[model samples]
Target: MANWNLKSFDDIYSSIAESAYKDRPNSFPKLFNKNKSTEIDYSKSKKDNEGQITKGGGTDLPNGGKVYLQPDSKKLLEDEETGYNAYYVTDTETINANTHQTYFAIRGSDGFGINLPQIKKGNFKEFNYQDWINNDAAFALTDAIVPQAKYATKGMKEKITELEEKAAPNAKMDVTAHSLGTMVSVQGLAGLSESELNHVGKAVLFDGPDTTASLKKAGYSDEKLKLLDKKLFIMSILLIQLVCSIVINHGINN
Candidate 1:
C-alpha cells in the first residue's frame, strides 16, 4: 500500500501532458510500466463488466496495483470547445479494499506545437486553436472564469459521482494540474459541493496564474474561497514572486 506523494503526482501530470503532444501508444504505456517490470498480469488487465475500465488498456503495476483510463477519456481528449484533456487514474494500494485513491490529472494548453503541425499538414480536425484563443486568452485578460474551467468543474463532478456508483465506494480523489490546467483545477474545485469536496484530497497546481479573480467572478464567496485555499499546494514561478515583491515594496513605500 504505497501512497503517492506530491512528487509522484507531479510526474503523472508531466507524463500525461507529454502524451497529449506525442503519440499515445508510444507514450501512454510508459506511464504505467515505468520500470519495465515483467510482473504485470496482462491477461487480467482487461476492462471489467462494470465498464469502469477500458478494455485492452488497463494495466497492472509492479506492486499489484491497478490503473485504468475511464471509458470516456478519448472523447475528453478530443473536446474542442474546452480543449479539456484529463485522465482518471486509480491506485488500489493507497486505500482499503473497498476504496481506492483516484487521481484526476488535467493537462494544460496544447500550445503552438500541437496546432501548428496540424495546420502545416492541412489537417483542421485535430487543431486546437480554440484552446488558445478562447480559454487561455480569456483567462489572461478577464475576470470571468474561462469556459474550460467551467467544463472541468462539470466533468470532474460527474466523473466522481459516476465512479462512486460504478467503481468503488468512498474512494478518495486528488487533483493535479499544470499551466492553464491549474486554472481549470482551482476554479473547478471551487465549484464542488461540500460533500463532494470532502471526497477530494489535496490539489497540486504548478506554474499557473492566480485564480482569485476568476473564482470571484464565478460567484464563490470569501468563505468558500478560503476553504479551497486550504486544500491547494501551489508552485509558482520566480517571475511571479519577483512581481509580488515589487508590488509589496511599492505599496509599503507609498
Candidate 2:
C-alpha cells in the first residue's frame, strides 16, 4: 500500500462522492482503471448494484484496500424522503499490523445535472430533484431535525458499530463530505456517543452551510460541540477566495 496522505485520500473521496450521481455499471472500477489486482466484492451487492436510479458496488483498491458502497446508498438514492448517501473505504495502509483505518465518503446533493424543466414535467420519476432541493432548504431554514441528517446519523452509527465489532481494537474511522453532506456529517458526528466519537479520527468537510443552529436544536451540548469542532477540518473554496480578497484589499489600503 502507498504511504497515507490526506491529499491522495481527498482526491479519492471526492471522486467517490461525485460517483453518487453517475449511472454507469463500471463507475467504481473506472476510477481505478480496473487494475488487475482490483477485486469487486459482490457478495452483498444486489444485481451487480447497477441501475439508473440506485447504483452501488465494491472494489478493491490497487494498494490492497477495499471500498464498499453501503447498502443504504441505494435506499438513499431511491427514496426521495431520505437524503443520505455514503461510500466506505478501507485505507491502503494500517497504523499497525492489527489496526486499520477506514473512511466514509458522504455524498452531497445530487440532481444538479438533471434537466430541471423536464424533471418538473415528471419526465424522470427516478430522479427527484425536488427532494434534494428540499433538503438544501431544510439545512438553510429550519432546525427541525432534518431527515437527511437523521439518516446520516443512523448510517454512520451502524457502520461504525459493525466495524468496531469486526475489526481490530484500535481501528480508526474518518469522514469526508461535501456541500449538504457537510451538514449531514456534522450532525451525524455530533450524534455519536463519546466512545464512538473517540474512534473517529478526522472529518474533512467541504463547502457546507453552518450547522450550529441545527446541532443546538438537536440537543448537542456546548461541550460536545467543542469536541466535534476539534475533529472537523472544513475546507471552502469560496471562503478561501474571500479571505484572499480581504488580505489583498487590506494591503492596498495600507
TM-score of each model, in listed order: 0.63, 0.64
The candidate 2 region of ten consecutive residues with least summed lDDT is 1-10
Candidate 1 residue-wise lDDT, 16-71, digit = tens: 33333223321232344322322222223222223233112223332243344443
Model 1 clashing residue pairs (backbone): none
**How well is each residue in 56-153 modelled by candidate 2, as lDDT tens digits?**
22243323324444333323323345745565656432223444776776666665547778878977765645446567776677765566766666
lDDT of each: 0.58, 0.58
Residue 2 accuracy (lDDT) in model 2: 10
